[model samples]
Target chain A: MDAEKKNYGKLFFSTFKLSACTFGGGFVIIPLMRKKFVEELHWIEEQEMLDLTAIAQSSPGAIAVNASILVGYHVAGVPGALVTVAGTVLPPLIIISIISFFYTAFRDNAIVNMAMTGMLAGVAAVICDVVITMAGGVLRQKRVLPVLVMLLSFAAVRFFNVNIILIILICGAIGAADTYLRARKGAGAK
Target chain B: MIYLELLWSFIQIGLFSIGGGYAAMPLIQRQVVDLHPWLTMTQFADIMAIAEMTPGPIAINSATFVGIQVGGLPGALVATIGCVLPSCVIVMTLAYVYYRFRGLTMVQGVLAGLRPAVIAMIASAGISLIILSFFGQRELPADLSGVQPIPVLIFCAALVILRKWKVNPIYVMAGAGLISIVVYSAF
Candidate 1:
């Protein structure tokens, strides 16, 4: 029993450690998560990792936090979930607190500004990579219709600035209808 | 009263934003620009640029920046807490529910619909950022001299290689930061 408890604590520690230090947000965290939970610890599998990413994305929260909660709960119940959220949130909270305390000095510094510009460029690249990769995955379904929906959504928001939330709601409706229609067709075939 | 309003607004953001941080951008922009009018588009973009440079989630950084703008330090605290609280509460509750309904078909159907929509949100965010970077500008600069596209290129290259080669991104981020300092004249 003692050994089992120790195991949970260690797993708990590692979960937050990964969460706290994870830069570039959700997609980048995927590989690290798989490395720790699926490969090293065997806590979950690759497919489950992918599923969790979907769940985390669809849920209303920061991706890192949602992922941490899901993984924490998976590993050691509610306590683990609590610890993971704490772990993920602690670093940001501390860093932001420090920045808030000395914000004026930090904001006015030229060196910091320069560094920030470079960092923003880097962030854009990271976000770009995510979009391209996910787009590729979506395209692989070999269904042109969803591909068109995705492109039109991009065009609408990017060029027309038609409000993304509305696009998402529209696409979601289409997806639901697609699923229902397919299910009905399958039932008819049976 | 203002602080309470700030807190509630962010909590609404946290609870309803279905596609994580990136997806929250448009809604957040609406709040910052249309409803709250705390920051202009330019300032919001600048703050977003700053958040990208720092560690942690962009949404939290956004909350901190906007909060500070609205009510100084106290506003930042309220906004940050508000941004996180709903998700934290919801996730905890969901953890319990997830265990019980791990095998239900309705749950499965909902997830299937949710997944692609999430991806769509991320794509939309990327587009939003791109628009924010270069939208409705009157004059193109005579030269690309003020902006060093090289650093951005190198950073992107490093990220692609890191993702492709399975390298540690922390080392990559640290290395990029150091390289940026030495390679450029601190702008």
Candidate 2:
């Protein structure tokens, strides 16, 4: 029981540190998480970490939080999930709350405004890089279906302004139907 | 009443926003800017910038910021809880089932479809942000006359630096901030 408590503590602290230090959003957190959990701590295996990331991405909510919950649950259990969530969220809550108090002042400050203007440009560039890398990954796979789905999704969002939720549901249904048909075909062949 | 509203709004955001935090931006804009008048478009863009710079998920950071703007500390708590609740429940449930059926083709196919869609959503979000950065405060079909040249230069430079050098995004942002400060002071 003591060992288990210690394990949970370790899980909580690691998540806390990871969330606090990580910038550039969810994708940036994954590699750092692997280093801390898989390489340094040996708390989770490499393969498990990959699976957790995949599930985290596919599941709802923030990938960073989801990934943390999976890793925490794997290491401990429900308690681990709760602790890690707190750890993952607390940093931003505290930081943003402090910023909130100074929101008006920050808004009025000319220097700060200038800096923010510049940062917005930089952020746009970073996001563009993300777009290119993700699109390249899909293209490299050379699968017609995924490529089609990607382009369709892009057009739906960019041109039609389709609701994001509806798109996800439609894609999910398509995926399920495709999988069911393939499974049935396999069964027939056997 | 406001607390409950915040909770419901974010719960929807949390539940529907798949792929990652960036994918949550449009949902957030719809809820905060369109459905509710909690924040103006410019303020929403600012929140996006702040959320990106800060540590943690963009969705959580956004929730906290929007929650504080709409309510107070209590509101922040409520909104954040609402935002993360779906994640905890869904991830925990999926984790168990996924481990059990790790080899299932059905699961793989669902993920395969979801993955690219998520990427497209993220790319769409990036494009919107780019528009906001260049046009500044105006919506789509922005007036070219109002376009700021310095930000355009900064955007191109930052993109080149990031793509060629493989530098961390934080440094690029910091450098841009410094350059802007210097330029503004000089002018």
Candidate 3:
């Protein structure tokens, strides 16, 4: 039990440091996680890390937090997951607190305003890269439904002004049906 | 009451933001910019800048920032928890059944379906931002007169550098900020 507590401490601190130090979150942090948990701490295996990452990516919410939850759970069960959640979340809470405290000051400062305005362009570029890359993946799949779904969903949100959440639900349903059909066909072919 | 509202809103974000941090952008934009009067498009852009430059998840950073604006430090905590709570429950359940669920078709199918939609959602958000940056707002003017030259220059250059040279985005973002500082100071 005492050893479990010690391990939980290790889990907390490792995730805390990762949350605090890493930038460009999501995929950027995955490799570092692999290095730390798989190579350094030996808490997770190589393939397991890959699987965990896959699960994290496929699940909802922030990949970083999802990945941390999976890692923590694997390392120390539900309690460990709790510790890691706290660790993963606290750093941003602290850092953003400082920024929030300076919210108006930052908003009012001319240089800060200009800088943020400039950064907005950079952020747009990055977002463009993401959309292009991800859309390219869907296109590469060579499936008509996913592509149709992509375009229609785009039109729905951008033009029709449909709610984003409603779109997600409908698309998820379609995707599940597509997968299930494909799976059934594959089994019949055997 | 405000805390509860923050929590519920972020909880919706958490539940819906599949695919990753960028996927959360549209969700956050909708809540803060469109649904509520909590933030303007420019301020939303500012939060995105900070969230992008900061450590941890963009969703977490966004939740904390917006929560602080609405509530305070405790609001930050509340929003952060709401942001992460779905992930916690979902991931724990996944871990519990990881072995049995490997290559599960239903789960795979739902995510597969979400892919194109997620891409579209992200693209929609990106285009709005591009408009916002180039025009200094999310909506475009009837004529070309309102275009901001600096953001246009920065946007094109950043895109080219990012695509052609494949530079680290953190450096690109910093470079963009620095260029703005220099240009503003010069003018």
Candidate 4:
């Protein structure tokens, strides 16, 4: 029993570490999640893992958190989910808190300011990289309609100051409509 | 009152926030700058800039920054908890039920559709950040001429190199911080 408990602890932390290191969020973390939880730890099987990602995205939360909970629960039930959420959330909370306390002082400091300015531009570049990667994915699927919706929503909010909730709802509505049409077509064929 | 406000703001952020840190940016801007007026656009942008350099989700850092801006330490605590609460509750519930229906066609189709949209949403957020990084609310910079391009170049080069070499982002962030301290001091 002790040994079993130890393995669960190990799984919990490993999932946490993988979650911690992931950048660009969610999908980017999928590979890491798979490597640690599926390939390395054998905590979940392949299909179940895909199931978790789907649910995580569709649900109203951070993908990483949802994924972690599902995987942790799969491995060790409720206790596992709690542990995983803690491990995932704790580090970021602590680190960000420390940062907030010092942020103002850091902002006025010239050298630090310059470095941060430069770094922010770098963030811009990184974002561009993600955009390119995502464009490729959407282009591959010939999902031009949704891609246009994303761009328009982004443009509307950023440039025109449209409400974000409205944008998401609009796109989500389009998605629903698309799904309905496809289902209806399938039904007719059958 | 402050703590409650902070909690409510975060609860809203947590519940509506899907995708990731960037997804929450516009809404956070609305709350911090427009609704609460706790932080200016410049300050919030600065916080996001720093958050990007740091090693965590952008939303958490934004919460901490806004929290401190509003009501100091306690405010920060309330906000962080609020931001995390929805995800914690919903995900745990989903986990309990997720096992029952592991794979179904409608589920698969819905996900297949959401995938492109998720990518779209994230990509758009990235683009928005890029614009914000370059230009603020009041006026757009005429050009990138005055900007110190070297550091920016080095950072981009480092990201691609690190990713290709599979070096951890923590190390990259640390290395970037070191370079800034050294060069900025020298200059």
Candidate 5:
């Protein structure tokens, strides 16, 4: 029981530190989560980590928060999930709240304004990097269907201005049908 | 009243803004800029930059920023809670069932389709950010007359440094910020 309590404490603090320190958002948090849980604690296997990441990405919400909840639950159930999420979100909440109090000062400052202008450009570049890396993963599959879905999704959003959730739902239905047909064909062959 | 409105709007943002942190940007823009008029386009861009620099998800950062802008400390708290509540509930529920049905064909199929769509959404978001950074938000028929060359140069340089040299994003952002401070202050 004592050991379990200690484990929970460790889980809470580690998640807090990771969320507080890591930047560039969701994708960047994955490797750090892996390092802490899989490598440092040895609580989860690398494969499980990968699976959790996949699930986190596929589900709604921030990937970082989703992954934390999944990992926390895997380790210690509901209480663990709650504790981990609190840790993960608290830092940002505190930081942003403090910034909130001084919003006018921060907004009106000339130096800050100039810095923001440059930071916006940098942020755009960082986002471009995210796009390339994500697209690279899809391209590596070397499959026609995934490529087609990717392009169609882009066009739907960029040109048609379709809601993203609607696109996700349509693509999901198509994927389900495709998989079901493939399964049936394989069974027939057997 | 404003607090309740903030909460409800963020709940929608948390629930419907699927994919990842960046995916939430459009919904956020629509809600805060278009629907509410709480923030202007330039202010929204600044918030986006600040959110990127800060730790945690962009969704949370933007929520907090917008909340403060609209309602202050209490508003920030309420908005963030609203933003994160859905994830907490949904993820917990899914976590309970996920491992057991890991092999469900429907689940696999949904994921197969969702993955590509998520990537495309991120790409689209990136393209929009690029446009916004280069040309200040001047509606569909953007006033190209307001285009600033310095930001464009910085953006190109940052992209090259990131892609070719593979520098950390933090460093790139910091360098850009420093350059802007110097140039803008000097002139």
Candidate 6:
């Protein structure tokens, strides 16, 4: 009980710091998180942290918020996830409140406009990085099905205009079958 | 009445926001700009820039910003709760499922299939941004006359540096902004 309470406190403050320092949200939370929780705190193992981050991104809502839920849940269960979510959301909420009051200044300033416009490219780059990093991981698994699914998913959205929901559903079916077949094969081999 | 609208719209946003991140952007655009007129296209763009510049999830920031614009602190609270509630419920459900059926091959297989598909979703989001920044369109066009050289250059350089050096994206973003200032000023 005491341990969980301690973890809750640590999770809150740690996520608070990570989310506060994190800019642009999404998968951006992962590296800062890995540094703090896995490397420093030893709270989660490296592979486990990777899995959590991947799942956090893969699911829904905001990746940063989703990640907090996952890392918090992994570390301390539902309550822990709640605590981390609070930590993650509070800083931005406070900042957004302040900025909204003066949004006119932000909206009108020429320099701000230029900066944001310029940052557009950088934002694209950051996203491309996410794609490469994630796709590279899938490729490295040396598994044909994952690689095939990954490419098909990309084409379906990028070119074919297929609904994302459909893609996800189809992929889920494929993935399940892949896992089932693989397991059966392994069993027979043994 | 507005609070209810805020709550309902954001709940929909949260419910459908499967891959998170930029995955939610189009949905937010649809809700705030197209469906509700809660914010104009320009205003939505501004909020997006602000969201990128700030910390926290884009969805939460938008919910708070939109709520504040439409109502006030109460609106902000309502919209934020709307945004977060689905994430809580969904993540809880999936996490529970995984934990409860950790050994279930069917469950693992479903997740495994979902994994790559999820990555593709993010990739799709990024590609849209790439098209927007480079070609000045949400979707790439045939003419390509609308191409913006500055962002294209920055995108190329930034992508290279990111891949090669593994630099923190914060600096890369700031640097792009700075480049914009100088480049635009000179022109």
- Quote the positional error of residue B154 for candidate 5 in Å: 0.6
Model 5 chain A worst lDDT window (10 residues): A95-104
Model 1: per-residue Cα lDDT over A1-190, one tens digit each? 7875885677667765775666645555667878888899898878778867666766677887788888888877777777777677656665665665676676588776555445544555555666666778877888866777766766775567676556656766776777778789989999
When 1 and 2 are scored with DockQ, the better candidate is 2
Cα lDDT tens digits for candidate 3, B12-108? 9999999888999999999888998878988888888898888879999999899888988888888889998899998899888895656555887
Candidate lDDT values, in order: 0.66, 0.87, 0.89, 0.67, 0.84, 0.81
For model 3 chain A, where is the 10-residue window of minimal lDDT?
A21-30
Error of 3 at B131 (Å): 1.4
| A1-190: candidate 6 lDDT, tens digit per residue | 8887888889999999998988877777889999998899998888777766656665668888887887788788888889998999889888999999988787699988778778888887877887898789899989888988888888987788676667777887887788788889999999
lDDT of 6 by residue, B28-139 (tens): 8768876897887556656776787788888999999999999998999899889988888877776777566543457656777777877877787677677777876565
Query: What DockQ would you assign to candidate 2?
Result: 0.75
Off by over 4 Å in 2: A181-190
Best by TM-score: 3
Write model 5 residue lDDT over B24-46, tens digit each, in one string: 88778768876798888777877
Write the residue-wise lDDT of candidate 4 on A1-190 in tens digits.
8976996788668866775686544456677888887898786889878878777776655667677777777777778777877676666667777877787788899877766655555565555555666668677776667667656765675567676656655666667677788889989999
Deviation of model 2 at B69, angstroms: 0.8
Shift of residue A143 alpha carbon in model 4, Å = 3.9
lDDT of 1 by residue, B46-129 (tens): 565555445666677778878877898788878888888887787767656766665334444544454455566566655444
Q: Is the docking of candidate 3 incorrect, acceptable, medium or high quality?
A: high
Model 4 steric clash pairs: none
> Per DockQ, what order, best first?
3, 2, 5, 6, 4, 1
Best by DockQ: 3
- Candidate 5 lDDT by residue in tens digits, A1-190: 9998997999899999999987968778999999999999999999888878877876777888888999899999989998888888888888877876776798799898889889988888888887887789989989898899999999998888887668877988888888888889999999
**Interface RMSD (Cα, Å) for model 6:** 3.0
